[model samples]
Target: MKRFQILFFTAFLFLCANLLFAQINAPSPIPDRVVLNLTENPATSVAITWRTDVSVSEGFCELQPAAEGPLKKEDSKTFKAKTTTIKYEYGDEPVIDANQHSFIFTDLIPGKKYIYRVGASDFWSEWFEYQTPSVENDKFSFIYFGDPQNDLKSQWSRVIRSAYRHAPDCGFMLYCGDLINRAGRDVEWHEWFHAGSFIYGMVPQVMTPGNHDYNDLMLDPHWNAQFTQPTNGPKGLEGTCFVIDYKNLRIISIDSAVDSELENENGYPMQAQKVWLDSVLQANTKKWVIVTTHLPFYSPKENRDNKHLRKHFQPILEKYKVDLVLSGHDHSYGRGRVSDNPQAGHKVMYVVSVSGPKMYEAGDKDWMEHSGADKQLYQLISIDGNELSYQSYTASGELFDEFILNK
Candidate 1:
């Protein structure tokens, strides 16, 4: 055990040293931490967000047909990005003052490929190509990752890379919260963005906030500044909780950390979200509904129950017969249905998974149809007209578990 600790610390130091060297030797003026996301309507709208040093204050995105020649820059439409000044501080590091830029290109031709890039003046990122979903409902697949909370650069990078390899054309990827071990830590966020690399620029990200994503009982400003999500959530929870429609599926993200952890301030109770979520689920017109929260209603870890969260949200989920609920927080993996008996009526399939190096012993409960301890896993979910298919895979690309649901 002593030798293992020594080796682990040595490797950690080595990784940090390399990161510092890269930052000191090579700094790009264009932009870093570029990521894509879906707008309220992904078929006709797409959003991109990125960060730049304070110098590059003004930014814009250029879009053109993917087939157009590279020299046709004059024919592309340039949209000015909304820039916000973001200041982040963590630990002993000096405060970071950076500019975050966001742009949502709307009224786009559906089912067509387009190349886009973001920057200002003479500095710009490489062209990134993306395709909009069909205007009408179409079959699509997406990847879901749970709690990439530890060893992001050193260990968690493989999980996301393998997932991309498994589903290169997935419409988008969803992070079920706990993206990092520390909240508002610039170094940790850098590790996360570095681990994902260009994958974030290719596939849009749908994310929720986990308990670990907060510092001092409040969300890190970096989250709201970096992720451009739908703003149709309840008060005090703008981007953290909202709903988006993609093809035939409706995804509702909930901020379970603040309320369940008793961090609610200024009357932002779970009840408020209960009312909003009930309405959201009630008004959902999509054939399929998938709700994602960081804390699981049915806990798979002993002594770590979120009864308050379940009390407020599970009824709505079961009432609406939500197709699936994806979540992570216990640092373990479990997939299960609501009932142990086969005769149970309508139920929602709940999944808790992990994607980082952290692991915890599983608490074998009767609800778990499949349970795994000390494993890093990702899930690929695909939806057709009347059916939804789910497959779980390990870091090595092994099929860990799978199931199918019919509407």
Candidate 2:
């Protein structure tokens, strides 16, 4: 009996020792902050990005045609990911290094469903499915949000989640700017990632930078590391200011933050974007044009006006007959046209909205068709042929404003 008891005690200690060892040295293969971005050609390619701890130096993605049933791993094709080390610092926290991995899958069949997962042997992410935009689906809808700047983890989470729930079939999501409060704060960025969770990984994001997303008008280094956007913009503003053609629609992103810097010393950024905007508008062939930026050309708050933005961008919008100009920075909801008379031939509709907890009082303006104050809202836009439908909903899923623009 004594010998049997001794064996039992010995086995219990051995089990505990192994448990501790496993806890200390388990391989971390899981990826965090997984996101999808529209490549230059959405019909044939998709861009995916994710972050892992330093343990993961290199990773690959396996993709296959998605079906209704479980994913068939045997039929998967592997694509190697490009990895970059991101060294970030925030206040007093020790500077740390993380591996940012990106993979752009090309030659994909348009409008087809594909399942993909990332990682290395024995440590891989669960299969995620995404559908590419197809020319066959000529008519589609997309969700747009102005700014998710403050309290992203607590306040902004439900707004985006609600928008996704409301329009699950939308092709992609467009964020105007001010994704987070601080430019280079990793904690804030971590909250931004956690707020959207896996929704970002599924829906492609086309985001522009707000003043909060930059440090002294220069973009955050971490921005380029995590997001892989089209490099088709002007010479300097590659990721922040670019254009993407999704099906029959052309979406243009501008960095309006540069206009504010124009007053200081760096006026070249705005001038550079101006020249690029003219050339881009001149070459547009899509049926619809939507431009997005951080600053509102027409401010919505009392004693607040972006004079530089208005002087520089409004003319191009008018010249191109742009359908919509979505903007943020006022932290209020306001929509109006270039002219009070909607029947005017060269009018462009402008909208400034907010999707975070922050709120500002709506100021009166003659050009506004609809305005709301202290409301956190998200917009659902549907375009079918020449008719474009726009709807704004409050955070709790209440419709606050609706309009349709017929071309």
Best by TM-score: 1
Worst 10 residues of 2 by lDDT: 20-29
| Candidate 2: residue pairs that collide | none
- For each candidate in the order shown, give its overall lDDT on alpha carbons: 0.86, 0.85
Candidate that would win on lDDT: 1
User: Mind sharing the TM-score for model 2?
Assistant: 0.90
The residue-by-residue lDDT of candidate 1 on 1-407, one tens digit each, is: 99999999999999999777645412246787889988888988998999888888798999988865544867699999999987777776756788899999998998989888899998999888899988677678999999998999999999999999999999999998999888888778888998998999889999999988987778877788999998898888988989998988999998888754644433555767888999988998889999998988777887777766665677777778788889999888888878322343567889999999999988978878988988889999999889899999999999999999997
The segments of candidate 1 whose C-alpha lies over 4 angstroms from its true place after superposition are: 1-28, 68-71, 260-267, 339-344
Give the runs in model 2 whose Cα sits over 4 Å from its true position: 1-29, 259-261, 264-266, 339-345
Residue 211 accuracy (lDDT) in model 1: 87
Task: Give lDDT: candidate 2, residue 90.
Answer: 65
Candidate 2 lDDT, 80-153, residue by residue in tens: 99999878776765455788899999999998999898887677887888999887636799999988999998
Residue pairs with clashing backbones, model 1: none
TM-score of 1: 0.91
